[model samples]
Target: MERKIVKVGNSLGVIIPATYLEELGVTYKDTVDMEFNHDLQTLIIRNQKTKPNNKDHLEQVVKGIVDKYLKEKGL
Candidate 1:
């Protein structure tokens, strides 16, 4: 597939097609990682960010800490 770079204010930006976006599970307000390949002379794209677990780990750690304190306080 080929794409043209258009001028965005002072920088050049390329628009991604909806087909490719859906195929790659990309959506609006999503972060994407971009890298330049010195060897292949191409642009490399990846999802560098990690999805946060729904269950809060910090809350669990805090609960454990609070439980230990309560036990020590004899409450």
Candidate 2:
């Protein structure tokens, strides 16, 4: 695939297609890590390493265990 660099106000940037972003599981307005490789002469884009909100996950797990324990006691 080929891309064109267009002028964006003061700087020039390449317009990434929506399909590419969709395939990468990222969308507009999301922050991504971009790196330029001098050896390979290529650009790399990747999703940032961020942990999910695990508070809800922990709460659900505790609730499930409590429910199972109560059920076993016929409560």
Question: Pick by TM-score: which candidate is best?
Answer: 2
- TM-score for each predicted model, relative to the true structure: 0.58, 0.61
Candidate 2 residue lDDT tens string, 1-75: 888899999999998888888856787688888889999999988665443367975796699899999999999
Say which candidate scores most in lDDT.
2
Model 2 per-residue lDDT at 6: 97
Please give, for residues 1-75, the per-residue lDDT of candidate 1 as tens digits: 889999999999999898877755778888878889999999866554644354774676588899999999999
Worst 10 residues of 1 by lDDT: 45-54
lDDT per model, in order?
A: 0.77, 0.81
How far is 46's C-alpha from truth in model 1 (Å)? Answer: 1.3
True-vs-predicted CA distance for residue 73, candidate 2, Å: 63
For model 2 the local lDDT of residue 18 reads 86
Model 2: lowest-lDDT 10 consecutive positions: 45-54
